[model samples]
Target: MTTESGAGARVNCVVDAEGRVALELPAPVAATRPHLLLRLRPKKGEPVTVSRTVPLEAVADGPARAVLEPLPALEEGRWDAFLLNGPDDTAPERLRPGLRDLRALVDGHLRDRPSPVAVRIPYVTKEGYLAVRAWLRTAHAEAGRIDVGDRSTTVTARLHGATFEDGAVVRLRMRGSDAPERDVRPVTDGDHLGFRFTVDHEDLAAGTAAEGGIWDVFVHPAAGAPPIRVARLLDDVADRKASFVHPAARAAGAVLRPYYTLDNDLSIRVATG
Candidate 1:
């Protein structure tokens, strides 16, 4: 909660592709016993907790490193992160243990403290859990940028560290409760991929909107390639306030817009006139 980088202990953390949490510590802690504590509390389900003794691997007595294997993928919801000095009578500080629910977080939110030097962010997983992911100082896919309008919708994205095979195809797949999956291939452009899909006015009517007009976006590569979710990475969601989201409502005409959720996934809002 403190904005100070090393207010208590200066540490750096990251989440790897395999879903493990890795921690790096400064010089002083190499001699003292170190412990890693992780707590996951979902919005609607039981909480999860994991603890491990961090083997102090010395690097010139300066920076130390440790890795904690991944916990089971959580049920969909929001989760908070804490890198506490686990229970040790010999250590200087012992952070309180146990996970906290959303109400606990809201009622007892960290306040009046220096802005937290946010080492981790609360994220939402594909399955719908609000969660936290390990930080990686590497380039990855950024799918937060999207364009939605009454006539059509467009998406432009690039996959970092990913290469496309020749003759591979990219597509935008959308579905609603009332409509079947609409798979449209996006036009490939210079370096990034671009997709433009038309929306019929009739599909925007208020009656049709109520049946589930909101749409989620996903990247569909070639037939054999695993579909990549077009999601916002880190802190790159620029259109949080303006994007249209939520199911469509009855109105005079159809209004289409895009929106980003707290978990950083993109959804479309359809309002029919």
Candidate 2:
């Protein structure tokens, strides 16, 4: 896949979410099926095998390399890649109606974001309150309350149960400042379906926290209040917010917010909302 983003090559592409996520290999794919496969690893967990195959029907204008689309609020790094059929394939330049249709499908995915962004607010501690503004330096497992606005779970659980050791195949990597990448995988859904994904964050342990800085994760869902965690990192120095999430091995998630302050009082405060 080519880097240095430009209008990359266009090929029929399909990205799977929670539902009927399937890909059928094109005739060309008959020979390169293995390389086309991507093994997505969740945070400290075993990698989940995405076995679907998407055959390139109509090739369109795209880059020489697969690119992680440059969107307004997309996390900096994650799994955003697609490989070309040939090393020096120039199919994107000479586009046709068939290829044009393929380009539209891929572009649609980039333009449509199906994820959440972080919105943090902080305040000084009050009589019974521990000041909400300090979530900036807090961890998701420790910081606070989170409410997903009553949205029902999208991915099924029975499909994504833990079938392997945590972190063995899965992976968790921070992409952008506002939020990191959280991914999960399960063995099978209750109905015997193959698998599913849930949002979750990789434990940014204290040892890994930047110098003079303490990193924490939270579940503050209000977008106006400190998060409340029901599950948390192994050693949450901050707090927890169970009301917002149901901890599942296949759940994936990320965090985004403003700046934070570590004060002389040994207390922390975050930037404005």
Candidate 3:
């Protein structure tokens, strides 16, 4: 919440391939029995917080190092980082981002891993404070490369904590409507799937009555399993709506655009003339 980093407590975080966070802190703060506290950013649901104490050790002349175990993963949300100076410290100070090393999360390192996929990425907030982005899903379809063609759009995604079945398909459901869902069978390769579906501009325009509306995307991995929302949340980028822009395809007096929602989920929008 506070814009300025408090108490000059800067932290450099290194996230390993297994989601372990190693923190390098200044010697003065480390000597105070420092504890790391992560408070989830307020949203529509109940608030959550995770706190862990740092084990102090003599570092000779180097900065104090502590590791935050990855067990008991955090919930899916943005968490603000705070540094509690000691056990008696009631008011924890917000930490500033020093250096973030998150290369282990690139290129779907955790793909094909066990069930209940867990991903945590450390990032600097817009307010100049250190925070973390966490995602926990029983089954997830991570949206990858997207190609917007004149007649259709192709979407490639990697599946985690789940596998594709015989009847796997991608579904595009119009928001707030009783319109029938549009389903497209995808090409599956190992743990990856590619969806090439026609973007029926005319039907979209008619569905929304010439007014633009959103179409949420989902992937049904198996017949019995529930459909998983298509999203992109593997790397260090906390937000992708502004950075990942797609070209609009215009046809039949309608304009179709694919975009990522505020929560990084993939969706389509249709506008009519």
The models' CA-based lDDT, in order, is 0.43, 0.24, 0.75
Choose 1 or 2, whichever is better by TM-score. Answer: 1
* Best first by lDDT, ranked: 3, 1, 2
Candidate 1 per-residue lDDT over residues 1-273, each given as its tens digit: 211221334445544433454556544453445554444443357444442344545566577666655443332333443334335533333222112122222221121111111223333334332234432322233443455544555556555434344444443334644464445555554544433334333443333445446555555445566555555543422224344453332334556666665555565555443
The TM-score, computed over Cα atoms with residue i paired to residue i, of candidate 2 is 0.22
- RMSDs, each prediction? 11.0, 18.9, 3.7
Output the lDDT of residue 146, model 3: 80
Query: Which candidate's TM-score is highest?
Result: 3
Ranking by TM-score: 3, 1, 2
lDDT tens digits by residue: candidate 2, 99-126:
2112222222122122232111111122
Residue 159 shift from truth in candidate 3, angstroms:
1.4
Give the residue spans of candidate 3 off by over 4 A: 1-7, 44-62, 177-180, 190-198
**TM-score, predicted candidate 3 vs. hidden true structure:** 0.85
